[model samples]
Target: MSSPASPTIPIDGPTMDALMALMRLIAAGVTDDDAINDALGGVLGADSDSPQPAGTSPVSSAALGRSPTGETPSVSPFDAVVPLPADVPDVTDTDDGGSVPTEATNTDGQPMGLSPLEFAVLRQNSHVVTGLLKAGASVDYIGGFSCTALCKCCYSFHKNVDLIRILLAAGANPDATTNNDTHSASCLIISVVKNNVEAVKALLEYGADVSYEWKGSNALAMALDFKKLDIAQLFENFEYRKAQKNRWERYQNQRRRDAEDREAKLDALRSRSAAPTGESPTPQPVDGRSTPTGRDETRSPSHAAGGGTGSPRSVRETAQLTENLGAMDWLVPLSDIEWGQQISAGAHGQVFRVTLKSTGDIVALKRFPCHDARSREGFRREVELLTKFRHENIVMFKGAVIDADVSAMLTELCTESLFDRLERTSAPIPWPVRLRWARDIAKGMTYLHTRTPAVVHRDLKSMNVLLDGSGTVKLCDFGIARLREHTFVMTQHIAGSPSWMAPEVLRGDDFGPASDVYSFGVVLWELLMRQVPWPNKNMAQLVGLVGFAGSTLELPDRAPEGCPPQFIDIIRSCFAKPEDRPSFRSLREQLDSLLVDVD
Candidate 1:
């Protein structure tokens, strides 16, 4: 607790550094200025006459009604400033229904000097505002004639506890009055509307007067008007006053219901305990089976059920190996597989259609069949991988369904594959568009390859790249992906699509990142030709074609016009000796330059 006589201290260097670092640490709450000042031997003692710090503009006393000495500026909030134009009314101060009113304007119809940063702070963007504050921005200075930071926060009805904490910790006066001298009692009321009880509690704890009134309206009355009974009761003896009494009725009812629930749970536990222990009440042993009777038999519900309650998921999942073979009929049907049309499948066992559903919403369903080892394992891995990722171009997992026989992963359905989109569309993709797609692909790959444990997408080719309705390319198919250092120890098997497989993968060289780059080269070639690479030749012929050193393939005359020479160069470089290939970062930079030139 702070002593009343201790002077308000300015932020110290260490405190300032912490406050600045707070922009990066969203959960750090607020920096302790007093503690930092105490540790620094009072260097942060309040400077009432201190000039504006470096990188900040001085508060112009003329704009405010007060002098430079921090005195009240004007009778009206707008007094020091020019009166608003006849067109821009003072609606912000109106008492019309409780809607949050927009800010009033000046006579010239221009809003006063509130910058976007100020608006962001007022709107509860604590993360962004903290960044501005750390950069030496001022929040204490009065604006719009005489409105303080607290007044702006109150007017906006911001609910961010972080923003509120930042303002208060930075010395914003909780009791500051508005231009109308309303003293911002209604601001606390607004917090209740936002369900920001913590902010209201913080304000009251900071000495904001709930008893203070304006136009016969006190904070308690404002709370009542907003129907925030819990907040209103906090101001007075909740049991004695009529409004408080009513508030307490609701609160007590809630508490009674909660207590009843707790007691019911306790009763259930007692009943179970009292009834158990006779022969351990284990499940009757199956024919010829020996039961493991005793406490171990009565494990938690999840332990007996296999998958725990609220477990994670993956883009892919596998089934356990022990489920009934007949149960397969109840889950994903083999007939649903549209052999040739569904060109791509997720590593986790999902399939999609190019056609839309009856509701016209395109959809994709990931299949998880129970008791299938591959599906269950894939599901776990997919859930683990997808949830941690968030990027604009990456595919989003919508939801999933878990049932006795099947676990279907849901994701956004893309209508076209990158291969099909390039070949079928009469309009050739512009150089800029191609470059953008290449960059997007690189970024997605970079995120996967550099993630902790590092994911290597063994299948990296055009067919695995899906195009949404907007033509944005998203990489899919993680079937061959493996976490670095996590050896499967299973028999060696061919993992990637044969056509796109690198030479090393066919020879089984423990597929690595460079192999993915090699496949990317084939994909680039396909994109340029707007057709499958080596269409006339079979897979065996293509493999044979790649064996020749220093061999280069030329695009047919029908290839898209105006393709960049640099893009072709990149593809060639990626397919060169693994050690000689440039990194994806270098490729992205080169693509970015090409995009800039074309744009």
Candidate 2:
């Protein structure tokens, strides 16, 4: 026997009126709480006797088919009211227009099937949508055309990014799609089709999958078809960002492993040193080297095992060298050194004088504060590059100490920078010393530029050229250096001190060997004048004058009286166009000839 059909539950007059008012509010996009309450209060009859709050609605849960205690009813009262065009006929009236029956039933026994959340989103009412969400509305509820709230918002005639953000924040899937037979697409794809850039951006920010396909078309392809180059580029940037993040994670993991290995080696060395002398300790192998028991294998043979034929080093000296070598195979331990006064300080790091306790070897320690992972990687790269340099005029790299908070590189200590010497003395530097200093700087630059992939010292100034106690100048500071590709290298942003920077660098152009030559010319001027470049002008004015006005440093007629004409000629050539600037090799030879004439 067939079961009897269930009786249709009728929606009350006041409930139907309140639902209709809410639909109107949603249609008008009225998300304001006070306005919504006022609209709802008029339909549901505001109680003057109770005098509710301004933003509070007088409608009770009981009016929506719940018990007086406010418990949820077996069926939602909203299910009985469907949103339709105000001028449209009821579901019962089926003309040649052929409107089908909805799932909801009004007092006249008509079915209306729209979900409250879907209706709220369709009307672009964030307030009602939030209310529905609080009332346990399903964010992913499928309504007309099998479209979810998010999908509907994406395809709405009016761009409603705020409503879409609300749905997304409330757990609406960014990649949810309508269940269309002919063509099904995600909210992102729909947003692209609608040409709503803001909606597309919101969806992507909330983790929209660009690779999602709909009817053989994806968001990327749709974006390209619509000539939305920015959106397409956004997808490419997203992929690149993901790749960079993965690469950084891998680099961090490798650094952690390397640190652990170094610690393990240190621990083994400490244990062996503490062992008794009579008993022979077992040799432990590390990096394919079997470290001899009771002796530091990393130390030179002349100083290892026992004292050499010469005078034996003191216990402190022996411990200092041995501990440093064992702790960091490629670096020395800070414990074996004593730090003196700080030499200089900058945004990311500081330089200080340090003495190696074993040999009383004085060196300059450049300490880089590891504020983030990027800085740590930069510090490591700088150390690696410095270790490979072996030029006489270039600062000699001693070793490095890599710690969690800070990393440091040790190099031969110099007495003072060329800038300091010039600033401290009133008299001009001797012509021979000046010539020798220029030659030394040129030689160092030549060596760097002659590398397989030439290294351009992007920041070359008088301050970066150091003079040892014996007056020999060595080039230092590679913080902003770049390894040239072909004959030039480009940077996204300008770097280096403005007063000494090349005109091309100031104009944000590609840097080459000639860029360094321009900076060298400025340093030469500083040496000859015994004063800072652009002493009266500020950085902005200086950059504008040098970069745009084609201005060069003024040559004083009285000063540098005995200076060779070749010196002035070299400076002039350096400041010319990039193609015309003399290479460091040519400059060095010219300086060499000038030095011979001075002698």
Candidate 3:
């Protein structure tokens, strides 16, 4: 009963004649791209040939714009046809076209028929257009401006369903609108008005805005009014999919906002922690419990770390035993945490993924048995270090609980440790991901070494580094880390793990940041090789081999597939003598240079 918004084409002109000839060539089934380009070049008298490579991406309404291919457009989409009648004064009625202007039009207020692709689409040359698209022709090219190629295809004489699909698959805008102010309607409405069943389906499938209305009447309303049973039937699936999509989008937006708010609060706390008058080092006990004294007067640090008689088992029980306490930047209420499954258990402490009852935010709860002065020192040191360091690659501190019954600290939860990820997955990790992890670890270590006191992460192993949800590396476990006071070099009494420890540390030599570099080298080797360091040796054997044997780790005979070969030298540089070893800053620079073109 009705037709689509059909914009006119100039009736007579050399440009129109050439456009007609191109359309006929495509209609005659000319599928060769080079031949078409040569023919088009001859007609336009162009001096050179331009070829664009087609792009591939997932389609969604969020995938916005006319050309969302992500490739650098070799030339403008309007290159095929342009410079339509600019001298003519367009006539407009006072109501519909009052102030809103429109795009280029000919003397009859129609677009010039100059674009070969648009003309080919109008002629329903599906195969010819597909070939041109694969050969790098832009799908939403706005050259001929019969408003868009999609709008023009809606009125193609026959069942041009395949033609519509070809254009959409090549990244055509399904929701494209005509340029005329009065007829500014979406391609969906144009197809709906023409009762083009297949065109409507194709548009909806390609994520056309279903709720879009033309002149206050939506596609569904128009279909029902016209008694198009087939088109009306499609609305059920459309509405359901749209509802689910909207729900997911809302959830995602809320999560993003919550994360922003939580990060803002944490930043405020971090700023407070860094002030000249920072958190009180003294432990405040709840439930009228006495403050922990030295090991001579109370339980030993080892006894607290292990199972102590009449000790609280979980954070929930610990919170239940506590009295009411006010919340602050440094101190949070013990009752706020909802204890979760235990993530890890170490000789020093137990960590759990706990949720905050007040904000519904999940965080890691590290409960150390700091029942005495000796045990509580680890909690104090870790808390102070966490507050001072707040980099992307470092774990973010939330708050701490220093109850006399149980001492626990809170930090951001991560997905898993690097060691666990590498050991559990049978398939090899992607090079880009592993490369990025190496860079992130280096960045965190560099941040520590560059501080005012030049803190050293004595335990810089794969297990100490963590991977977040996005695969970003976050360094943790600073219990054994040392802050160099008067001098950069100091002797560590707390020995690091044998596998990742430097030879000097094992031999009790004067150590500094170079010791950490040696440990980082072993981690780099793990990332590159995906094999355990000194796998054939035991703890005692590893200590002797790496410490007293004067032996160095060797690169694999062949590099791991997809891994950069330059990292082998980086590892070697890390294993060099104290003076010759590269700084963390230097190591980060080397990895950065190698990953420049890798991704």
Which candidate achieves the best lDDT against the true structure? Answer: 2
Q: Which lDDT tens digits does candidate 3 get at residues 49-156? A: 222135522111121113323334444222244223233232233122332122334556654433456545644556557655765567775554445566656643
RMSD of each: 26.3, 20.1, 26.3
Name the lDDT value of residue 357 in candidate 2. Answer: 84
Candidate 2's TM-score: 0.45
Per-residue CA lDDT of model 1 for 333-415, tens digit only, reads: 22232322553554435475522332344456656543555656556555445555676666776544444334555567776
Candidate 2 Cα misplacement greater than 4 A, ranges: 1-328, 485-493, 557-559
Clash totals for all models, in order?
A: 27, 3, 0
- For lDDT, candidate 2 versus 3, the one ahead is 2
- Candidate lDDT values, in order: 0.52, 0.66, 0.65
Q: Candidate 2, residues 93-197: lDDT per residue as tens digits?
A: 222233333333444544333555656654455788887666555576443325566775676432767888888888888887654223578888887777777
Position 351, candidate 3: lDDT:
94
lDDT of 2 at 597: 94
Backbone steric clashes in candidate 3, count: 0
